[model samples]
Target: MSLDFVNTYSQLINLSADADPSTFYSTEDYRKLQTLGPSLPTLSYPFPSAEANLVGESTIDVKLKSIRPPFKFTTELKAIPGSLSIYKLKNQLIDEVVSLKEAGICASNLKFMIKSKILTDTTTIGLLGDEVSITVMITQPSHNDTSKLLSDPEPELEAPKSISKGAWDKIESVLSADLGPEAAKIAVSKFKQVSI
Candidate 1:
């Protein structure tokens, strides 16, 4: 059975676009996407065998470590049995991240990292099973930057000088093409009210 891996990966892009960082983190799907295995070691045995072996945990602490603005995390997208070209998938992710950054919809203080790497038959056993995959990471800016980001006023968009019949028609047509017809109609109505 062939699965549409491109569509699956596309959903990730959509998720980023539709949901903010906090909202995304709150979802069950995001919880499942967390890095597997205990990053910190416990005194418990590493194996379930009769002999108990105590392992020393890493002394390095994350809190003590300085995390700069743009904290980053990586996620891997595995290709389906009959998926599109790996390059296409990689490009889609890059484009989506770029779009999100350009739209300023990422978050108040956070920046989306747009780096991606393609892997095939590598040692890295991505979140999914062995398959052609793309590993992408996005950066989460530091909490300290939030206040500054929120303090800044959003730049105002330039309103049209006058919405003539021809201009209105053009606006509606462009909106309809970009968004759906229903959204375009509502937006045009709103724009008209604002211009008045």
Candidate 2:
């Protein structure tokens, strides 16, 4: 089943001309909405290990250092997989972050961009090989005359805003009810990451 209710409720936010979202809304409603949405972050045919198949963590942090025009943005990800080109990941991450920012989900338009390179030494000599991955994140504002458009608080006025905290839980239930266990598990994990 789709997260029709959540989507529907979102559509009716501020009481639009659509269906009665209040009828489907609850303190735990946003969670329910996510439940009706699509499945994300799936593991392929053969199971992919969180280790080997797992690419190192890549994080993009945008810091709004000042409240002026031409603001600064810093994005940095440590322990990223060198095999993956930094430009590709940077571009993709920038796109996604910019989309979220434009959608008004992120805090502010003022942002800072920071980048870091890391190397991990791994050995597979014994019967079993062990891999350890570490991720580090840093935050700082920009240091220049800034003029960036801050995101409007339109999302705050939406019904989804009130239920965002419980959105993932409701979404998990919806997914479990619709998709199989494997898919639900993957979705739940993805949801948790976003929830954080």
Candidate 3:
């Protein structure tokens, strides 16, 4: 069974935040997370299609410079197959991070560098997609006494590819069978349609 693309991606993002970066990054879990990034455009599809079908591709690059104490990073977004105003999207992201800080989920050390651009006009009845690549690096804070000690090297381990596949299957089954068509439709109705 196939999972909702957006939900899967969202879950992956949350999981990454909760899991140890070394373990998550070294395993196939990270690769599966990358797959979710590319499907963003398709997942953003608005319901009740007009006479003309909209299609486009976008690429998002996220770099996590640090994940300890204070998170720092940069992101770049570029539309490849359609014209898109990314200012709103960028603002939304920053707002979310700020909200997290306000809620005490993250420290005030959070910082982001963002660059976005629209590339081309949308094409009708064509393929629309997005590719996202994320790089993560975790560093010890300068103020920490442990920073003076030698960093413990991550243990070499085989990447567990089946773990993610199993997770996907479990999530797909629940979403497909438990939600029901009506509930899913109602949920989708809540999101505002975006103009490509």
Candidate 4:
């Protein structure tokens, strides 16, 4: 049998705290997270009507970033059958992160919005009727070192990608390997969805 999907999902649930996960909804912060505002209309995947439907509830995965605090975090969501909307689901995740931050369970970080789309499958017709589940993976700056910005904090320097490419690549490699090829690719894909 294929690797236990639940096991994969479990791993995602416990993704490392070093990812700087947090919930901040301000536009400026959201843009800094590299996300275009939430999709005009939140996507929704209505509960399947048939009881026999293989809803794939067990496959839903959630991953946190893998870097330390004093940073911002973004969660990129992915799904199969591009039509399967999960904007609300992402919002809920954001809310959870925020609550966790408020409770001191999680730290404050730059907030980011999620972008959702179906995976490699092209058959869009009735895609939602099939086994579809949404997954979230977090992205964050590689280091908490803001020394460069401190000396000359310019609007250009505010963007992390320009300053953190090398560090981000290293973290991405370690994380991708940890997630395994397939899952790692999915996570990376989600990362690109927002980053682009």
- Which digits, one per residue and each the tens of the lDDT, describe model 2 over residues 105-194? 222222223232232223111211122222222223333423332443334453342336477677777898999767987988876776
Q: How accurate is candidate 2 locally (lDDT)?
A: 0.43
TM-score of 2: 0.17
Q: Which candidate leads the pack in TM-score?
A: 4
lDDT scores in order: 0.45, 0.43, 0.41, 0.45
lDDT of 4 by residue, 63-118 (tens): 33423343335443334223323443434455656643443332122232223443
Supply every candidate's count of residue pairs whose N, Cα or C atoms clash at under 3 angstroms: 1, 30, 1, 5
From the highest lDDT down, the ranking of the candidates is 1, 4, 2, 3
Better of 1 and 2 by lDDT: 1
* Model 2 ranges with Cα > 4 A deviation: 1-71, 99-196
lDDT over C-alpha atoms for residue 12 of model 1: 55
Per-residue lDDT of model 1, residues 22-110, tens digit only: 64555686765544322332455455543322132111101111124243333343332232333344343444455435534333333
Q: Which ten-residue region of model 3 has the weakest summed lDDT?
A: 117-126
Model 1 residue-pair collision total: 1
Per-residue CA lDDT of candidate 3, range 24-132, in tens? 6666766655343223544555675543434333334332232334445444434422333333333334454553334333222223222332222222212223443
